[model samples]
Target: MFSIVGGHPALDLANTVAPRPPGAVEEEYLPDPEALVRWARLAGVIEADEPAEPSAAALADVLALRALIDPVLAGQQLDVLLRRWAAAIERSRLIPGPHGSATLHLGTDPALVIGDRLANALIDLVRNADLSRLRTCPLADGGCGWLFLDRSRNNSRRWCSMDDCGTHAKSRRLTERRRSRR
Candidate 1:
């Protein structure tokens, strides 16, 4: 299952690769072209009515774009990400939006559309988003290393989801306290 906790399309795409505990086999939600299309629809990168099915090479490009995103979110390897952004921009067009706005129109090629959209999204995030608000779920806190924008008033968010990782961490702490009291 895909979780859209990243708060951005690019980050959401990066999270398609599920994070796992140590010794557990890594889970990839986007294992095939169909899966990529499904996720793109869910992430609002593509429309539900869009009849886009990426080819194997296109899928590979999407996955590669995702790989580049994680490092940029972590504040490393930025030049590599910028290069990909340039390529995506080269293949895209700036089109008019309603209310005097503009939108980046992706090419019709299903193979490159998803990657181009993701790259553009990533660049938008880098330019407009508060990089300081970017936070990764801490693995030591029973998190799956998913990234999220911490928009909390206090900016103290530490888990991807309180119902999931936060509960695991709380239960662990309670058990430890009980044992230590014995």
Candidate 2:
């Protein structure tokens, strides 16, 4: 999903973002502004040597916030689109993970739980900001879903992986040509 990440560091400190898999448990949370204000307080939760499951009451508020990403699923994951990075680094590449789940961490240890924590922070970023000017991303998390990021240029950047989409589109064209010749 297109995650948005930008703000004046109040509740926008989404330092560790993570990619969600299809079957991953929902953390029993949704995400809401009011609850985010409260949820952000739990930033320390992920930081704990062994954090507890976020308060059930808080988890209820979080999960009730925005459980799905919209039309394709539930709703436009407003936070997903807004949870992007501020760095202008071009061409993001995938990093290997220990469990065979490719990961892209904003930190030295990609598998660390903090990455997910950072992503949650970015979620709060979008949840609290004005999104009238954000640009829509077609695919991210390897086509898991869509996301929205603030584009400084007029160019449209959808998926995070150009290698896959760019290369696959070309491959499809070649295959179609071979089949047509038969």
Strongest candidate by lDDT: 1
Q: Judge candidate 1 against the unseen true structure and give its global Cα lDDT, from 0 to 1.
A: 0.79
> Model 1: number of clashes?
0
lDDT of each: 0.79, 0.38
* Candidate 2 vs. true structure, TM-score: 0.33
In order of appearance, the predictions have TM-scores of 0.83, 0.33
Per-residue CA lDDT of model 2 for 81-138, tens digit only, reads: 3442222112234688788878653323223233344444445444664455433223
The lDDT, on a scale of 0 to 1, for candidate 2 is: 0.38
Model 1: residues with Cα > 4 Å off, grouped in runs:
20-25, 74-77, 96-102, 179-182
What is candidate 1's lDDT per residue for 1-182, written digit by digit as tens? 44788888877876776573232438888889888888888899988887676688778988888777757866888887789778877877778889999987775566777777887888888889887998888876667887788999999998878887788889999999999999
